[model samples]
Target: MEQIWDNNDWLESANHWVTKQLKLQKINSIGRLKPVSGWGLGHVLKQPTEQGDVYFKATAKLPLFSNEALLSRYLHSINMPTPEVLAIEETHQYQLTKDFGGGLAEDSSATLWADAFEQFAQLQLDSLSYLKDFNKQGCLNRPISDVAAQLQLLIEHPQLQSLLDSEIILATEKAIAKLSHNIDELSQLEIGETLVHGDLHIENVAMSDDQCIFFDWSDACISHPFIDGTYLYRMPDSQDKTQIIDAYLKPWKQHYQPQQVEQAWQLCEHVCYAHQAISYASMMLHLSPEARVELNTAFQNALSASLRSNRQTVKSTTCVRSKFCGMVSGILHTLSLIQIKAGEAL
Candidate 1:
């Protein structure tokens, strides 16, 4: 199987397509198209134009990864600060967007992280009204109601079964049953579903003045917003994420009390891990054998974490509150931030 970047004919055609799009926008290409990154998952290339660098990205065709170009434009239409899309070729899953500078640095202050979390939470809350539009635009619809069935399907999938040991498979099955019970309890809370970033972290965000420009919508979906909180709280280099968690929950305060919110979070804790496992299972279908070998460990880890969370008892409200503070505070820490090179759409 030839990778997209390795195909000479495709590369030539892609270059011509990029040049034509730039010319239509009255921009001239001043330098050769440079490959910034490429992998089995996706590919990124930079086109140096008179205006500056414009990026070209092609996301692999996958069940969970949506058509990012279309989704990003829709998000921008809904007033989300996404990167400016210059051109798009839906058939090839290709997108061209203007550069938005580097994302948050490794040494960014806690205040910045808190602000981002709060702002993104507000965005998630606001996105509830657009749930129908999100669904229409091909965003994955993985509601709590469908999770158990999805897990069962994956468990029965021959490909996935081949990757897991007998013990872990048994644990996963038991965990899925437990997860169904927990989902029923969570549904009683009536927490509205909203847009989940699916893969939220500091690297996917770029700050412009007071506005937070969030890119990389490939993993975005319409689900419970707290699923994103799990990904955000686990961002590298943060020893204590209570402030981050509190900041994320700030926008939801008007809707629920701290205890209610914490309970909902605990109930959905294992759900997020299960969701990751499902995502990886979908990816396995599209990956080559070599790539699948690389992904096997991550897939197993997600399943293991899901089972691990299932065995733990929910913490008391008092302990949960103590572990999480109400206010966001300022502090500095060194995060291993990925530098946004040539439109870090990856």
Candidate 2:
């Protein structure tokens, strides 16, 4: 197999690879192999075999490939709700696994979210003993220094200058500095480390009958388990956020005091916001000029909205400045971050 440089090449190579795999498996007919969107460094195609429907994922991102393969196997061994790895083409960084079909709908019920969170919490709790294994797989332990460094990169990025003025930039920096200080304090607190699905949004989860299967373990890491709750905070306002959080923490209560659980939850919420800001900033570095413009415009609009929301409570000049700084931080953290779509020209 040749190196896949872009989405077209990836699709072509993946089709050939899946076809060969189908033949080897003695599946005579193959269904339409459609590409799954929203992935940044991989090509995933849904494959229909005589046996059943499965998924083929191929990535040139070696770290992600290795992490997913190792972590999925570990999760499967523990009977977690993840797809079963059927085959691995290590030489080419491709893997075949059972497909769980389209994930929960965009408007999936609150009950579904609760169920997923419960299962995810259990997975996190059960995997604590295997932290050493996760470390061996090169999963990142997100220390305060690393998080701070990422924030610094985002602050220094050339692209940010185009979107924010000097005043806004300064305010944003102050807000980030405060966030960094908070993270430093949180880092000092003793917390359990476990397998965190670094990108556990609703889209990453799929439902098959009664089973909830999670895929896209590319961002899996050995970090504070609360990091996984970032997606829960991004859920639609219509859903009961309190109920979802309660369901997620219910399992942890078995081993932790209520106060400890709440503290971890609060720390994780802040970490999630900071992590998102850093991620978007990092992504900005790789994006094309056109994509950056789109993102910049979107970010500015969000920032403006946040500023309006802050004006009501901010009376004194000092309070206004503080609110402005927080507003900038919140805007960057909550921006509807985008990636170059799988098939779109980059």
Candidate number of the best TM-score: 1
Flag clash pairs in model 1: none
* TM-score against truth, every candidate: 0.85, 0.74
- For model 1, residues 111-159, the per-residue Cα lDDT tens digits are 7778888889889888988888987765878787888889889988988
How many backbone clashes can be found in candidate 2?
0
Assess each prediction's global lDDT (C-alpha) against the native.
0.78, 0.64
- Kindly give the stretch of ten consecutive residues in candidate 2 with the minimal lDDT sum: 305-314
Clashing pairs in 2: none
Candidate 2 local Cα displacement, residue 136, angstroms: 3.8
The TM-score between candidate 2 and the true structure equals 0.74
Model 1 has a clash total of 0
Which regions in candidate 2 have their CA more than 4 angstroms from the true location? 1-9, 29-32, 36-41, 59-70, 163-168, 235-239, 287-346
